[model samples]
Target: MTATTQPLHGRVDPAALPRHVSLADTVGQTMTMAWRATLKMRRNFEQFFDVTIQPLLFTAMFAGIFGGAISGSVDNYLPLLIPGLIGQTVLTACVATGTQLREDMDKGVFDRFKVLPISRIAPLAGPMVADMIRYFIAATLTFATGIAMGYRPGGGVVGVAAAILLAIVAGWSLAWIFTWFGTVGSSAQAVQGISLMVMFPLTFLSNAFVPTDTMPGWLQAFADINPVSHIISAIRDLANDGAVTAEVGWALLGCLAVIAIFAPLSVRGFTKKM
Candidate 1:
């Protein structure tokens, strides 16, 4: 009888592997993943429809349909409609994040990602960071459409910039909730349906397309309490009055709260799937 010993050929040294990824490493990996997501967006140009065509089309349709009815003229409605459209567009753009995330997960993209030696949060956060570009595009086009339609913002350039920044931030914050949904949802279609269900009420029920005072008492109360309403009001104050009011503070606070709550939840849910 003979005993045989196995050779250690091509064996990996356990100590050679990174014990803990550093902060800088995590950030770098996140940025790398973000670049990948951006490249995907560029390749699939249709992914940009929500940020571009939708904003322009909706702005025109709403202005044409409701402008004269609400504010006596399209020009008069620009100030209110533009800000509301910015919020709506940004929120709409955010829906794609969850839908795409679910699609990727279903396609086994995240399964491949699970084997990579990078920060777990990077996969979830990267696409979200890349989505900021869509938010910016939607916000910019909304403002440009308003300007083209003779909607002069009294808040000037600085005010408009602030409003755009607010819209992007708010959109990014709200996206975390959808990302969490994507992490838990069974399919891309399911996530899209859930996102739309949440978006319609928040957007339409808010003071987005019309004045809250004109609404019934109960609806007005809901609109006043809606976070979307606060964000839109903040945008209006910044773009129409050139002022940072308490609404701006509330909007930012709400964004922080959403990120605080949903970001962790998304990460946890994603980890469970992994």
Candidate 2:
């Protein structure tokens, strides 16, 4: 072949390189990144504290504290608290996504990805995909703990299953917000601080622990509009009533909206760093 057509002196032709990572390649690379993240989790076993221990601690603690005051008994409170706690735990678990990403970047881990021809989002998304496992664990253990605490779900197995799935999806989508924060935050500690600030209000200000009507009018207004409230309400409908209510649809739509907005912002911010 002519020098013009072939690479000169073993130099690669610019056109021979792919300008963009294909959908398939991006998926594969993302999975590889997920595998890497899992290994990190295994080595840093303490990374599992929130999922493994918090479920047991909070489920029992909250039931005892608020059960009698709210619903006249711990057993009676489980139906409401179980679903609410699932949302709280899953969302709380996702805060680590941004913190860990910030930590990795601070340690110069992402710099290694710069030399590889892969999707820009793979590094950002891979750990988050692995984080789904944490969400699953958190949600499952919360339900299991609730069950052990004399809490029975009227939605039975199928409804509980659907709620768990929804919680996982919500966790994954919401993680994109933290992932974006990771890209923009100055440090891991800064990311953690900001994430907690955002997370606490989102969790506590909603109808996660109490009935919305219990709050004052303005607070109830905020609770009614809180996406976390919608999520908890959706879970309650599915797990306690076995009903796929309008709240479920709204919660999922909110999740999709979060992904659409934050995913792009995360990718853009991550790429700018590259």
| 44-156: candidate 1 lDDT, tens digit per residue | 99999889998889988999999999999999888989999998888888888999998998888887666567787899998889999999999999999889889899999
Off by over 4 Å in 1: 1-20
TM-score of 1: 0.92
Pull out the clashing pairs in model 2: none
Question: 94-190 in candidate 2: lDDT tens per residue?
Answer: 8989999988898999877775678888999999999999999999999999999898899999999999999999999999999999999999999
- Indicate the TM-score of model 2: 0.93
